[model samples]
Structure formats: C-alpha cells, structure tokens
Target: MTKESDDNGNTPITGDEKTSVPADLLNIEKGDVVDISSDDALLMALGYKPELKREFSYLTVFGQSFGAMGIAPALAESLIFSLGSAGSVGLVWSYFLGCVALIPVALSLGELGSSMPTAGGLYYWVARLTPTRARALMCWLAGYMNVLGYISIFASTIYGATLILVAAIMIGSDGTWQTTKYINYGLYSATTILCFGMTCVPSGTLSKLNNTYIWFQLAMALAVIIALPAATPKEYINSASFVFKEFQNTGFWPNNGWAFMLSLLTPVWVVSGFESSATIAEEASNAARAVPFAMVSSLLIALVVGMGVVISIAFTMGSDVIAIVTSPLGQPMAQICLNSLGEKGAIAMLVFLWFTSICNCSMLLVAASRETFALARDGGLPFSSFFRVLTTNKTPARAVLFCALVTLAEGLLMLVNTIAINSIFNLAIMGLYFAYTMPLVSRLIFNEFKPGVWYLGPKLSYIFAVYSVVWMTFIFTLLLFPSYPNPDETQMNYAVAVLGFVLVFCLVYYYFPKYGGKTFFHGPVRTIDEVIATNLQLEEQLVRKMTEDRAASAT
Candidate 1:
C-alpha cells in the first residue's frame, strides 16, 4: 500500500503527479487505503470535489435525458404548431428533417460533454474553451443564457402539463366544463410546486424514479402508436397520400414552403431538454463517458420513436387540422384523441399523458436546478452562496426553490397576454440553442480543444462542430421570425424582443458596479486544493492507525 519516496522526498500517485505529496516523518505511507475513483479524480482535476452524489449510472443518466425529452407527451403538447402550419405532411416531414439536421448538434454536444463533463454544462465549456482575456465575459453570457433557458424550460413544461390537465378535466366532464387562463395559471402554479417537491427528494431516490419512468415513457409511446391505429375507425384514418403529401397552411406565412419550415419548431420544442444529461454530470457515475453516450443515444432513440408517434397521429388524427386546433377541449392532442378514442378512452389516455407531463416537468427541474447551482457555485448569479447550498441529502434544494420561484413569476406573463407567455416559452428553445452555440464556436476557434473518452476524433469532431454552429445559427434566425408574415398582437412573435432584453440584462449585470461579475467571478473556481488537503488528512490518520497497530502488536 505504501510507495517509496524518490530522492526529492516526494511520492507520486499512479495517475497524476500533481496529486503527489511529501513522504516525510510524521506522514502516512499508504495510498491503497485511500482509493480515489477515476470519476472523483477527474472531477477534482476539473476543479471540483464531487459534492453531488454519483448515484446515476449510465442507464439512469440515459433515462434522465430521455425522460426529460418526454417524447410522447411533448409531441402531443406541440402537435398543433406543426399540424396547423402544414397539415399532416408538414407534421411528418418537418419532424423527420428537423431531427436529421440536429444530429450534428447533438454530436457536437456529446463531444464537449465527453471532454469536460460538468454540471455547469455549456457555460463551463465556454470558460475553458475561450481565451483568458475573454473568459469572464463569455462565461457570463453563456451562463445566463443557459440558466435562463433552463428556467424557461421548467416554466414551459409545467404550462404544457397544465394544458394537459385542463384537457383531461374537460374530456372527463364530456366537454361541459370550460377553463380559462386564470384556471390554467392556477394549475400551472400547483404543478410547478409539485414538481419542485418531487425534485427535492434525495438524489438516489430521484434517480431510481427516473430509471423506472423511462420505461413508462416508452410504454406509453408504444401504447399510443398502437392504440391510435387500432381505435381509429376506418373512415377516420387517412391514406398514405394524405399523411405524406397533404399541405395545409393556416398561418399567414408567404408560402407552403415557409409553413413546412415553421413546423420545424415542434420537433425543436419537443427535443428541447435533451442536453439535461450534461447538466447532471456531477451526479452521474463515469460522467465523461456516460454523459456523452447518454445524450446522443437518447436523441437518436427520440428521433425514431418520435417519428413513429407523429406518423401514427398524422394517419389517425382525422382530416381537419383547423378543427383539431379550434376544438372546444382547449388542446389539439386532446381533441384528436377524443376523435379517435372516444370520451372514456381519451380521458384515460389524457390522464396518463398528464402524469408523464408532470414527470417531464420534474425531470427538467432537476436539470434547471443543477444548472443554477453550478452557475451560482461559480459566483455567476446574485446571492450565489445561497443558491449554491445543497440539502442534507446532497440535493440542490435552494436552487430548486429558486427555479420554482422564477417559473411562477414567469407564468404571470400569461395573465398579461397569451402572446407574451408564448414568447417566454419559445425563448426556452431559442435561448438553449443560443447557449449550445457558444461552446461549439469556442471549440472551433480555440486551439485548446481536447477529446475525452467518447470523442469523435480530429476530422469528424471538426466536421460536426462546424456543421453544428452553422445549423444552430440558421435555426435561431428561423426561430426569431413570426409564424405569420403579417401579424396583429396575438399573432406577433415577441421572442426576439425577449431575447434582446435577456442579452441586455446579462451585459449590464456583468459590468454594472462593484457587485458585477468582473468584481468577483473568475470562471469556475478550483476546489482541488481542498481535495488534496482532505486526502493528506486521511493519509495522516492512516499513519497514526498503523503506528498504534504496531505498538499494540509489540505489547
């Protein structure tokens, strides 16, 4: 267990010499007694001490991202956006192309995640990948964008859950009961609180629940895919031509081409939270390997399964896209389900979808809170110390509460105007992709890019990184456009304005005054010294134990 000191009176560890220490008189000798895991060592090297419990194995980590995507329910939540834009053909083809185009983005994320897996996600990557002179400013920009996106995701998903709940209630009531925005806001608030509570459980417990829920997601998706075709009357089912070739545009966009492109938002929204796997890297075992593998694999699975769900719906969702959108039930998917499955069956399906929607909110909340905690840990946010505090069970309770409060406040926008709330929700998708763009751009411009265990190597990595940046920029531009060419208040898209406000806030906050990020923040702070100190203490304790053992044996 002991290593012989070199002539310089220092003993080196097996992995990194930086972890070596002096081997003098009063010191401990045993290295085997303190077996540091690779995960812990790597985390230390990344300037952290593994504060979060590494409870999520590869499967559970994969489940985290997969469950966050909430493929079946998320598709249902955004189906109207696609179905209304280009009918069944747009619904199917747009999803397929959008998913195909995003593969490079996902691959680029996997590369960065593998190289530098941390809960800080994109911002940490930005800090490390950029030059020292620009590190703090770029880090601030990336961190705020990432955390804001996370909060927006939690709010939007909870809102989607609210919609599902209201739809379920109306269907259960046989469409006699009506709902308003006030009712919707109340349900959304309750669901947000409920998800925050769910996310406050011990990390181990939540990981287990996520593991179980991933299968539930698959089962529910398969059930709908199968049951939709089985339950739909032959008269209601559309033919292959109608499913694949029909183009219906209700928006005021210039042409059917633009309408089809607009449909891309649905898949983009559905796949919004797949990066959640990276946001939990600190809590995942073998994170560098697990995070990348989980992220790309989950998206790949979503691509196929999501296609199945959409195509199934396109065939069985009936011919009237406008009717589905304008249905009295207040949800497009609910109306489609009611048409295909009837009242009782639709209620059952909606209830299950509602439950999964809640789980999706919780899953997204976990990522959001972890992201907030990471940024706060780096002294990036106001009251950083407070939000960085973890609960007794090693969960980010304060960050969870902070995110929940933000979600509740953002939900108030629904009361002001529906379009305003929609802008905030759309901001989630735009802001997240904006965050995603920085690290890829950094890797491309900086020469310090390093590959980890799951890398795509030199040429392929550059290829993916290049494509990802180009594609994300194009998509972000597309996202800023309003659904219609000419629009009134309700039809106007304000997401661009929202994004501009967020950017201004970040710029102002970073350089405001003595409390600015420039004053205290210096990228991610290193805790490696603490780790080394703890190891030295443990080694000294072992030395004392050995001395006592020898004395006792001699006596």
Candidate 2:
C-alpha cells in the first residue's frame, strides 16, 4: 500500500490502499454516495480539472450546436450541387434522407459525450474506449482529423460568407461589378479575423452571443421561408409537382442515381456540428444532460426548419434549374432570390445569408479552439504546453488564435482557383466524419463502453453505432467523386488528396522512430487524484452533518 500527496496537497490512496475505504464513506450506501454534483466535479472525474467557465446553459449549448450547423445558410452555399444533380426533387429528398441517416450518428456521439464529456470530444472518447495497445494510435488519428475538420469548417464558413457578400454586392450593383479572386481572398481574410475576434470575447459574453445567434438563425430561416415565396412573381413560382418531382442531371455522372447520391453532401455537411456541443461539454452547465440533449434536439430543430427553408426555395425557384446553377451571380441561392424577389429583395436576403455565415464562423471557432486545447493538454501536439494555455478569463485564446491563423492560411489556396478552394468544404465533411468513426468503431469492437446518463438502451446503442459507422462510410465514399466526370485539373475533387495527406501525416507523426508521439502519449492522462480528494472532502462534510444531526436528536 502507498499514499502520496497530490498537486492540491491532498493525500490519495494508491495501489492496494484503495481497498481500505474511508470509515465514514463505508457507512454510506453505494447508491447514496454522490459522485458528481456539478460540472466541475464531473470534469474532475473525467480526468480534467475544471478550467473553462460553466456559463452555457442548455439553451446556449443548443445555440452553439445549431449555429455551427448553420443549416439554412449552409444549404444556400451548397444548393448548386443538389440543383445540378437530381434537380428540385433531389434538393428536397436528399436533405430528408441525409438527415435521417445522420440521426443515429448524432445519438451515438451523444451517448459518448454523456459517458465521458470532455473538450477533446471525439478523440478523447476514442482514447478511453479503445484497447490499450491501440489507444495512442487511434486517438492520434481522431485528434488530427477532428482538428483538421474544424479548421476546414471554419475556413469554409468564412469563404462561403465572402461569396455571399460578393453576391449581395453584385445584386446591389445590378450586376455592373464583378469580383476578382484577390477581392474574394481579401473578404475571406477579413471575415476570418472578425470571427477570431468574436471567439476571444470573455466566456460570459460568448454565452450571451450564442443565445442571440440561435434566435437570429431561426428568424433568418423563417423570414426567407415566408418572404421568398410571397415575393416570387406569379410566372416564376413552380408547381407542386415541379418542386417535388422534378429530376435532372447536369453533371456528367455515368448514372443519374449516382448523381442523386452525391447530392447528399449538402445535408451531410449541414446536419453536422451537432456533436460540436460535445466539444464544449466541460464548459456547459449540467454537461451530462445538457450536452446530449443539445446535440439531439438542435439537430432535430435544424432538420425541420432547414427542410422548410429548402422547400420554400424550391417552390419559388425559377424553372431553369440549369440557369440557376450556371448563374453569373456566382451563387445559386443568390440567383434564386434574384429571380423570385427582384434586385432589392435579393440583396436583402443575401445580406441575411452573409450575416448568418459570419455567425456560423464565430460559433464553430468556439468548438474548434476547445478541441485544439484539449488535444494539446494531452501532449498530442508539438508545442503542447503553449497551445494549451488558457487566457486570464479562461478562454482558449491561444487555440483561437491558432485556428484563426490556419483559416487565414487556408484562404490562400483560393489563389489557385475556386475549384481548389472547394476542397476545404469537402475536407470539412470527410474529416469530421472520419474523426466520428473512430470512437464508434472502438466502442463496437472492444465492447467496453459503459452507458452514460443520456444513453439509449444497450441494444439500441449498438444498433445506432453500427448504423452511424456504415452511413458515414457511404457518404465519405460519395464525396470523393467529382461533380463532373472526365474532369480537368481545375474541376477535379482534390479532397481525397488533402485527406490522404492528413492521414499520412498522422501515421508518420505517431509511428516515426525515436521522436514518435507513441513514446510519450498514453491515453488520456488521468487527474483522478483531484476528483478523489474532492470526493473525500464531500464525504467528510456528509459525515460531520450526520453526526451533528444524531446528537441534536438525542438532545
């Protein structure tokens, strides 16, 4: 038996000493023992001291997830893909099918978040669930992929916002002005910096901002759904049959079914970031309950509201879907609005889209920075100590700054051409899904998963996990195919190359000779002693109270 004082100057029993439980604690029934009563305690139990402020309520956490998903705005950005593939019918049905497919994925992630809520999110879950021998490798892949996905999402959000802003300008200018690549890059850089600034605000203000953004998102979607149809010229409004049954294939796919499957990319990307709430689990009040509920509920809301928004657009969108796809305005949504709502209304809606896009960028940076900090704290990165430091206000300021820099750098790729920049959006979906797969695969293969407070039943949990893995694999494969077959250098999908590079980097970084991360990385470093000490203090308080109550009764 051995005992040692921990960093907090509390003596924690180690090895065989753990068997001799405290006398006071021994009298307490197992069920009566309070393991966690607050977010701080729960965090400590999960091997991390509470560092971030727990200011986000259930609503704010939901806002965080929903804002990151940016459903309506994201759909506007990716509408071209669906319109080109299966036409109006594809846009409506593909979103429904994709959202349905991803619900199981969200449920599986919610269960893991409840069981071991942490900022590391996917990577941390992988580490805790995988076999000892494979823990470091699995965690490394998940961590890098998760980080890359968030960075790519942030980059794409800013880029998408820049496009919306430019589209608005062109509409406002009556199509007299044209945007150059440099102009787009300049706008992307500015938006990235703005989002970074937003992310660096104090935690309390950030929570309020997130709450505000949620209502803002809802209002924007409702406005477009209600107004776009009302404003459409009578001649432009499509019949119900056209809106629901129209099918066309403008892309050069060998089969129309294959093209329809590829259109699932839009909803796959839009319904994502539900797991984002899990990334800030430690920073949310009642994290065990709030995290999972926020994830599932936010996704549900995004799906229903997002579908309404898309359906409204389809009803009002002009008959020439191909013309909308090949619009000179550079955005399919912009073209749709222009045809239905005239110049001023189009500009107004595009401005709303631009604002929502910026909010999405800011919201996503919060999750991205937290994930970066979590990985760095575990010695998973090169400058772990530096990246892990928190601001005086407890924000992961350094991580925010790092992500912002990466977002800015990624914008440089646009210099090559818009097609090259498209890879960022593709990588955003593929990389996140790749990270999501690791923990689910680990749970199924090891059979070591313990149900958390928010889990489905044992059988349902396995079912969801299996379904999520298979669906993600299917979507991932579809994303690798280009929009057009026999594509030249400019039209090719380079997401496969980019994702391959990241995977190879992860492999080499962990397995390379003497300096490999495997030598230093053990699963999540346990700070169990902190929680042990806290539990001991709570037990002592309970014992003291019980003794006093007994004496008073005797008197």
Candidate 3:
C-alpha cells in the first residue's frame, strides 16, 4: 500500500483507470491532496473540473427528459401538418407503427448513455470512441451539428406554442381580434425570456418544478383523453374514423413511399430528442443508470399516453377535418377542441396547452444550455469562457441566455421567408440524429469501449448500434428530397441548405486556430490519473515526514 511520487515529486497515479489532468491546473507537489470522491471528480476524470452543481435527482432528471418530449403539445402542433401530408388515418397508423423504427434507436442510444454519460453526450463519446488521429475533427463536426439541432428544436417549439396561444386568444374573441406575425414573434421572444428565467434557477428548484411538469403532462393528457370522448356527442364521435377512415390529402403529396415517409416525421419528431437525458447527464446524481432509463421511459410514456391522446382528438375532430386542419385560427387542436368542447372549454384547454408548451420550452433550453456549456468547456466554441461561465446559483446562465437570443434570431428569419422555415425546424432531426449516429458507428467499427455500470449485453448491443447507423443514414437521404414536392410556392427543402451551412461553418471553424480550438482539442482529458497522482504524492510526503520525526526522536 506504499505510494511513490512522480518525477515532479508529486503523486504518481496508479491503476489502469487513471487519467491525465487538464493543462491549466497541474501545479501540485508531494502531499498535495485533492478530494476525488464526488461527482466533480467524475468531471475531472473526463478532463474538466466541476463547474455546474450536481443536485438533480431521479425525478427531476426524468421530468427534464419527459418535458423535452412534451408529447401532448408536440402531437397537438404536428397533427395538422401530418394529416395534411397523409390524412387522419395515415398519420395515426404511421405514427403508431413508426414506433417500431424508433424503438431500436431509443434502445441503442440508451445503451450508449449507460456507457458514457456526459454533458457533451454524443460528441463527447465521439472524441472518446473515435481513433486518436481523427477524434478532434469528428468531435468538432458532431458538436456543431448537435448544437444547431438543439437550437432549431428550441425555436420551433416556442414558435409552435406561440401560434397555439395566438389562436386561442383569437378564438376567445370570437374571431374578431386579428394579429400579425410580429405579435407571434413577440410572444416567441417573451416565452424565450421565461425559459431563460427557469434556466437561471438553481438545480433543485427546476427538479421540483419538473417533477410537477411530468405529472401535469400526464394529468392533462388523461383529462383530454377521457373528458373529450365523454363530453362529445355519441352521434358526432366515431370509432371507425380513428381506426380506419382516411381524409382526403388534397394533393399535399402523391400517395407513395415518400408521402408515408414524410408523414412519419410527425411521430419521429415527437421521439427525436429522447437523447436530451444523455445531454444533461452531468447534472444527474446517478447519471449512468438514470440517463439510460430516462431516455427510454420518457418515450415509452409518450407512445402509450401521447398516441392515445392523438387518436382521441382524431375521432372527435368532426367530419370536416380538412376544414379543421386548414382553419383560419392557425391551430388545428384549438379548432378540434372547439368542435368537441364548447367555446369556454376550448379556450381553457388551449390555455393549458400553452402553459405546458412554456414548460417544454424551458426544459429544451436546459438541455441546449448544458450541451453548449460542455462544448465550450472543451474549448470547442468561440468565447468558450463566456458560455462556460456558471452563475452564483451554479447554473449556466450565460449559455442559456445565449440560446434564447439565437432562438430569437431564428424567429426573425421567419419574417423573411415563411415557407422555407420548415427546413430550419427540421434541422432538429437532421442534425441531432446524424450527430448521434457518428459515435455508434465508430464504436462498431473500432470495437473499443469501456462499459459502465449500465450496458446492454455484447451481442444485442452491437446489433442495435448497427441498426441505429443504418436507420439514421436512411432518414438523412430522405430529408434531401422535398417534403411536398413540385417546385412551387417556395416550399423547397431548405433543410439541405441549412445542413450545408452547418457543414461549411464547422469546416471553416475547424481550420481557424485563433479561435483556439485547433490545439488541445482532443477528447476526454486524462482526469482520473491527475487525482490519483496527487493522492500518491500526499501519501509519500506523509511517510517521509513520519520517518524524519522518528529519526529526531531516536537521537
């Protein structure tokens, strides 16, 4: 049990689990001991010291993930577009069945969560799993791709909620109060401000609110499921409609693989970022176990509860669903509620949806801020120190506010080209899932990874990993094609250009060194070894001091 000092007369870390320290803070001599027992030590093991507080519990962690899913609001907003593309029955069945494709992704991602739970999530894994020579480039690409995805989801979510809120106000005024897109933008900015407020709170407070959030989501969904059906006139409600009736597509897309695939986006979007749990792993008290389960269970909750809610809305939406989808109110869910529940009921329901959407926006901001903070800590972004700064409350205040500002900027773009904005939002899918696939691909190809406390068995894990890669590749190719086809009305697949911009920007950033990303960009700094070294030196110093005292006493 004797300890030896390193060449610098400091502790030499023993054992295979040891890691090197970050360059900035390696000034330690013999007997210089540092606490390496807490979660901050875990960050040190990954080459970063503890910056943000770790106070999130299992429920708060789960609420954060589930809130990101925001099942009911997502279903409410996307239904009109999905139905327009594939009709009522088309979206219902496609989404239900599309769960098959997503199951493999969720499982595979959860497996990764068990292995490398980091705030950087996939990109951090990319740096760890990829070959030493290529790790920096790939990590850079993954980081940019993933952040853009988070940013897009943030903006799109708040914007959709804003539309619903506006529609509800108009409906309450009996369709007399008209508003402009500027009003919508203003609401979007205001919600972003609220989201920023939530992000500024200390860890435990958000966890408590998120605990309320997940339950509220479930209660509201169940309320709608049972109340809507019970109150609707039996003559107006039809089981056959939900199960089999297909509404006219009105030529949004020709009935083909493309149309069905496009409709699949509705459900896929609902399930897209289940990986949010992984991104916030640093805050979770027991990340390895909690992140994996949270990622999978949130989606399962969404599928079981969200699907039922969607089917209920469809059945009670009345015979003229096309009219509902194409309503002047700009919210199909609001119109559908008006049909089933009277005016008072519709307004009340819409208000609840708006409230939940605000919570959803805040949760999304939390995820994005964590990811931004992680990337900056690794010196991946310009002004890393600024984004990486933690407030007195131990929250990433600057990072979260930066995300809100970016969301506002994106909303401003909507004023320029309303139709192409779909591309910007769709990046949430294209960017994140693509970033996700990279590490799994490297692990599969390289066949090297250290298992965590939680992991799938060897054989099944590889199969699912390979499946994730193939599935993401397919989705990417499909995104290249236009959603509604035909070169008219500027409804182009602007996602292609957005993706191109991401690629180009990351490429440019990778080569430019003044940004300081060029040097020391390798992933997973040898954090464990540094602590072990310090401890070893401390033990040696203690031994030497005891021997000196004994010699003097003997004399």
Native-to-model Cα distance after best TM-score fit, residue 465 in candidate 1, in Å? 0.2
For model 2, where is the 10-residue window of minimal lDDT?
12-21
Give the lowest summed-lDDT range of ten residues in model 1. 17-26
Best by TM-score: 1
Over 4 Å off, model 1:
1-34, 530-555
For residues 13-51, what per-residue lDDT tens digits would candidate 2 score against the true structure? Answer: 222221223333323334453333345545655677556
Give the Å error, residue 178, model 1.
1.1
Predicted candidate 3 versus true structure: per-residue lDDT over 270-330, tens digit per residue = 7665779887787787677788888788878778887788788767877666787788888
Which residue ranges in model 2 land beyond 4 Å of their true spot? 1-36, 528-555
lDDT of 3 at 329: 89
Between candidates 2 and 3, the one scoring higher on lDDT is 2
Candidate 1's TM-score: 0.91
RMSD of each: 6.6, 7.3, 7.2
The lDDT values for all models are 0.82, 0.83, 0.74
TM-score of predicted structure 3:
0.87
Arrange candidates by lDDT, highest first: which order? Answer: 2, 1, 3
